[model samples]
Target chain A: MYRYDEFDQAFVAERVTQFRDQVARRLAGELNEEQFKPLRLQNGVYLQLHAYMLRVAIPYGTLSAHQMRKLAHIARTYDKGYGHFTTRQNIQFNWPRLDDVPAILEELAEVEMHAIQTSGNCIRNVTADHFAGVAADEAADPRPYAEILRQWSSLHPEFLFLPRKFKIAVTGAAHDRAAIQFHDIGYEVKRNEAGELGFAVYIGGGQGRTPMVAKKIRDFLPEEDLLAYSEAILRVYNLHGRRDNKYKARIKILVFETGADVLKEEIEAEFTKIRASALRLPADEIRRIEAYFAPPAYAIALPGEAALAAARQADPGFDRWVASNVTGHRAAGHSIVTISLKPIGAPPGDATADQMDAVADIAARYSHDEIRVSHEQNLVLPHVATADLRSVFDALVTAGLATANAGLITDIIACPGLDYCALATARSIPVAQRISERFAETARQADIGDVKIKISGCINACGHHHAGHIGILGLEKKGEEVYQITLGGSGDETASIGDIVGRGFASDDIVDAVETIVDTYLERREGADESFLAAYRRLGATPFKKALYGAA
Target chain B: MANETARLWKDGGFRPNPWQDWPEDGALEPLDPGTDALVPLERFVADPDVFLARKGRLGVRVAAGEDVAVLAEHLENIALIALEFPSFADGRNYSAARLLRERLGYDGEIRAVGDVLSDQIALMRRCGIDAFLVTHGPTRAALQGGRIPEVRHYYQPVSGPEIEIPAGSRPWARQPAA
Candidate 1:
């Protein structure tokens, strides 16, 4: 939760007025289609297949109760009674009129939000661990760095219009919840021999028409030289990255074209020139920025704070939610409460207006009014007291938000496919809903263990299928929605893209296809605690493919 | 986007019945000349000697030997400094325009010619572009060009060297572009 300073506030406010004028001119017939196309896009107002979709940046998936309520208000007043929370930790309203966008932007600015750089070729909303300051295992909060990048990249003169959209995600944990390895630019917070915190930088990792695990360029980039080093990378890409064909435009294509070694050499040379200059982060500024994301005050210790054990002994319903949704906290008396959006039949990342309000109220009451939108398409009450876990679970159940599928089999990261998105080739929600139905039994889900089932409607990989433990890609085959499953992908410190297990399954067979893989894992897994990814690595896709395809 | 209201207008464009004295809007307004067409920057033939001496060069300047630091050389003389916006995203011209006026301080007919859009008029002025040359069409035609890229711009720069009536401010004319 970084609050806007005068500079940040002024910058966003001015951008809103700028967009308002641009919209006025367009409506007045002062600008034509060709001239206005790029303008609209840069502001995150897209002319989709159906209507204009404005994507509001929820920077790194963090939101205060105020911001959430504002989004809910926007949904009620300007759009259909809902908003689609995207995988990048942003929100998209599907049916905004072209002319009303500036007004929409004006309203968003009131909440310290604007749509700048949300859709442009510039550095996008810098994503970080959604559990940044809350997770018990976190080495350091990643939001300070994310916020720093946000301020520097907003309307960055040189890199605004790049060859294609750029994405960066950061994580401080040894376990990668942020999916850093799958982004265009990924940063893993690591400590060197001297115990200095810096980033292990990865470049060219992305999923689109071509998927790649970003190759590491810097073993450790000193924290201070982040901007200079990033500029060096983007400058290199801008000068050399392809623009001839849209498909080959991403930095991944360059990595593929000029091998990682050559690219790394070029970046290092470029970094040397800028690192010794003004772009370097001074210690004071870094500390000032870091202070915005300081952890909430928590009691050092709670005697017998095994609230989970107490709740489990008292109530079965609370026990199920606690077992699945409650996770480790950085503070002794606090726990990370994940509010699952994936109900039995609803879309994975959608929130109805009322549900949004309820979550906001819950966050305000039980969790310091701070809310986090996970890349997994779930909301997180990041710093809830461990003692209040059961009460929060109770409120969630009443609101129909309690699904007990945080990291379990049914906890799916889904993209808005053909149903709402213009880029989708098939329906991802239906596929996710079907799989969730197959694993609806609480006991069955608990027994199956933590398996990330990510479904992407198309190659954009918004659902993060590449990092899912079991990635399901919904594609069109001869005009029918077919699902292709991949095994063993991970999004942590040891991240890897899931390998295709076998041929795709038809829409009807997708659920059975998932069940088939799970059955294989159960039979071959060495023990109960070894998760799906561990088993897949131990056994590989060959065993799973055989299990699904049979003999052949 | 609104087609119904568009058909009601005659040539000069949609005025209700009692319109005032204006051209019937037949021939489109020709664009102002480009640097190559104008005689200044286009005149310096590979060197700055002749242009500096004010010899017979009646053309616009790419850069006369009058180094920005040697401002004493050309104080009274009028010149034009045109910022080339190769593309909208390239902000080099933005800084270049600001320095030419506020810092190194060139007092001349500052012009933003290439790829100039009407919406940027206010900004171009603040940064010092006094005149403009629309590359493709007449100014009126350029006005109808699709969506304006930004609803708001952080800086003040105009599309051309024109005195902008800031949205709600009183109409007070400051020193014009040159």
Candidate 2:
């Protein structure tokens, strides 16, 4: 929702020109692959298994209709007419040539977007709750603070090449939709007892080969000291994080190696010295950023409960979609609508060019010309009128974007596994597709209730399988793709990594194993009212393990 | 060997390095008085008084993982602080350079020595590193020619003069005057 001013415009324009020169140098053999690798990565270009994948940043998961249209245009012109939305709330174009990258960047710049920091060991795209301003339980819209961090960390001179890539996520609501606990640094916007705003800072949390839920480093850091405190954390990590082993290079390992108390002392010392510097965000600047995220003008009216109920009675499909996809909004007469990108048997987050265009059109018409990409691999119309829900659903259905499974068994989050990623040891998309097809019936998925199935192709956990209700991690055991199942992981306010059930199953047996686990939950649940996550919490992984592999 | 032709970039141009530097061959020794000697921090810390007594320009070569805070008290006396990169991916020195400039307010020459590639030159410069001890021929040529591609506008405030946003304009839109 934030518009680019002239300075921001020129900054991105110049970056495009700079990247264009880099590409030219690479093509002319003036720079080798080793020399060009970091440069290309900083601009979001990756040398994947099949082709160069360019990931474009959607800062704070916010997009305008015009920007969505431009993304569709890019997918149509440069890529293979489709783009995959990643778990970081960014989108990836899997097929873009080296030469076309600069052109693609130029187009992205026109729409106030770029691929900067989407890859490489720099401060990555700052993410926040997708329902930041619109959510009912929000303390403050976290986007303002997230945008401040975006500006502060972009091409940060001191942190350009950290020991490893750094990820920062912010969440405004008490619900924690941003998965704050799994990031390198997570900020939960909080208000003190005196009613002054600040942040509850968590550090040293990440999921890769090693998974860690972030530990709280500061109970309450004043909002004004945000950048300075962040600098302190980064400075400590940059100066001390391991550089010898790439696997142990993350800040999480540093916090683990040197106890959290020692790390906190170091961070506090650094913060003391730098807290009064110019990096401390000014009040006017905070207010200026907050103005950009103010709620859209809404028609004051009662909730559209009667009309929604009548429509649901008329069409069970619409009723099911409303039940799963619609979420409460802060403003009356408006609801947050999630358009499921995880359609049956398709890649978890892939949206065709036509689908993107249709969503853009729907946003322009039914919503307030704004779109949001959810970390669960879905697009959100944050301010859809409750009356327009059916119309929007109809348009989405026509464009193949309608899937009545949000937060249901069929709605899955999966990484680009062996199909595209060079780091993948096993295939992830096919596994997600198989599970989706196995539970394609809407009634069955609704009956099963909210069970998140997340899959990752490797240990990197890019698919965030560690946070799934039923987590599946694909590994190569003696040249065979084996699926390891974990149960009872959740990424909400009460964040916890899932535990592995037992020995992994072969790829052929994974789908049936998942079904058995789901059926096990259905039988073991207190009632249909209790979700899979809640049931798993009540009954630990023992029953699920027994269901997957026979009782030991 | 290419090391013989290694050029030093300082004060916006390349020049032959005046200071004599030791090879990073895992050895430490006292300073040689006739020529400027850059010794490892451990060597210098073993006998700071001996290094201080030398009647020549003194410098210290710090590895990426070394605690740079040890050099804080000696910032005013040291002529150069050479930060090693070990590998281009190891970016600890970038933080070290900023600490020297911003935290310690050390204004003397800060040279990026090892694995100083062309792509990182602009970044190193922005972090208050004013010099480079470059061995790669093409990288040296690019530095000498001022051909390292860089964006003029910056989003973050660093160790340089803050470009004031024009009054009545959005602060983020302000760019450094051409």
Candidate 3:
């Protein structure tokens, strides 16, 4: 929703030209593969197993219908007619040729989008709550700040070659939909007792080979010091973070090794020096950015409850969908609808070009012209009038986007693993597919209630397996693919890393292993009111471990 | 001795390199008077006053892993500080350069040396490196051709005062002087 000003336009156009030249140099052999890798990565191009993958940043997961349609066009024209929305709320085209990538970037630039900082060892695309401005519980919209950070981190001169990749996530609500605690830097926009706005800053939380929950470095940082504080943190990390071991190079490891107290002191010292510098965001600039994300106009009154209830009662299918896919909005008489990308058996986040176009058309007509991509690998219609729910549902059903599995067991989050990823050690999509098929029965899913099954092909944790209630990590052990399961991990406000429960499961047996864990939760839950995560916390891993690994 | 592709780029174009690198292992004694020798930071810090009081102009070359804090105290006397890249991908010096310019307010020449490439030239300049000792062939050619690829508009301000911050625009948006 943030429009590109003249400065923004010039910046992206220049970047496109720069990247195009770099690509030409690479193709001409003026730059070797090793030399060109980081450059290409910074532009969000990765040479995958079969071909190049182009990841386009959907800043803060916000998209205009026009932008969404452009994405659909890129998918149709360049890539295999579909795009995989990643866990970070960005979209990846698995089969874009190197030659076509600059063109794709050109197209993105025209739509106020570019893939800058989507990858490589730099501050990555800033993510926020998918239900940013629309959520009923949010204190403030996090997207404006996300946009500000996006601008600051783009082609940042000092931080471009960090020891390891960094990710920052922000949330403005008490319930952490953006999973802020599992990021290198996490911010929760909050109002103090005196009603002054600021942030609760969390540092160093990430899930890779070594999963870590971020430490709260500051209880309150004033909104004006946002960029300054972030600069301080990054400066400290850049100067002191480990470069010897790539695996231990994330800011989390720095926090872990230096101890949070010491790291906090160092960061605070740096903050004290630069706090009054130019990086301190002026109040006017903050307000200027905030204005762009102000809420859309809604009708003064809309009679929707009766109509929605009638439609639900008339069609059980519609009722099920409304129950699962729809959520309450901050504005009265409006609802936030999640268009599920996770179908019964297909890849978790892949959406066809047609589905994308349909979503764009639907958003343009029913909701405001805005669309959102949730980190759970689903698309969101953030401001649909409640009266239009039935029409939205019907359109979604026709487009095959009306899957009533928003938070159900079948709503899995998985990465494009060994199938397309060069970093993957095992196949993750197949495991997710098998589990989705096992839990395909809507009745069974309803009985199970809110459960998240996440799978990653390798320890890199691209699948976010460490944050799932039922986490499965696929590993190559002795030339055989095995899945290691973890229990009780969560990415919400109550964030914790899942624990590995005994030995790994063979690919053929992973689905049954997942089913066993689900069955154990169902049997042991206090009541239907207790979700899988709550039940796991109460019961601990002993019961789930026992169920999976037997009495031993 | 410098790499074969190393060219002295300062101000806006390549010029003869006046400063010669003083090897870390080489003895500090017996250097010619007024010889512009860039010694390693470790050697310079071993005896800061010795280098500061030397007849020749003082320049210190800092490795990517070395601390730049030591140079803060002697900034007024130092003529040049060469920050090493080790490789183009190692960016520790960028932070070091910013610290020198913004934190320590060092106005002396800040040069980027070692593995310098065409793509990184613009970034080095923004981080307050006023000069470059480029060792990549294509980078030298690009510099010679005045074809350094760059996005002149910046969203964040670095230390230098020459950068223009247009009024009424977003405070963060900056453009380098034409």
Each candidate structure's TM-score, on Cα atoms with residue i matched to residue i, is 0.81, 0.97, 0.98
Native-vs-model 2 lDDT? 0.88
Ranking by TM-score: 3, 2, 1
Better candidate by lDDT, 2 or 3: 3
Model 1 interface CAPRI class: incorrect
Candidate closer to the true structure by DockQ (higher is better), 2 or 3: 3
Model 3, residue A117: what's the lDDT?
86
For candidate 2 chain B, the 10 contiguous residues with the lowest summed lDDT are B165-174
Error of 2 at A505 (Å): 1.0
How many angstroms is residue B140 displaced in model 2 relative to the true structure, after the best TM-score fit? 0.9
Which regions of candidate 1 fall more than 4 Å away from where they truly are? A303-307, B1-178
List per-prediction Cα lDDT, in the order shown. 0.74, 0.88, 0.91
lDDT of 3 by residue, A1-552 (tens): 799988889899999999999999899998899889988999999888998889999989999999999999999999989999989989999999998999999999999999998889999999999999999899899999999999989989999999999999999999999999999999999999889889999999999999999999999999999999999999999999999999999999999999999999999999999898778888888998899999899986888999898889999888888888999998889999999999988999999999999999999998899999999999999989999999999999999999999999999999889998889999999888889999888878888989988999999999999999989999999999999999889999999999888899999999988888889888998999999999999998899888888897
Question: Could you tell me the lDDT of residue A185 within candidate 2?
Answer: 95
Ranking by DockQ: 3, 2, 1
Q: Tens-digit lDDT track for model 1 on A190-292?
A: 7899999899999998887587888988889899988878877886786677766878988989988999999989888878755765466777778877887
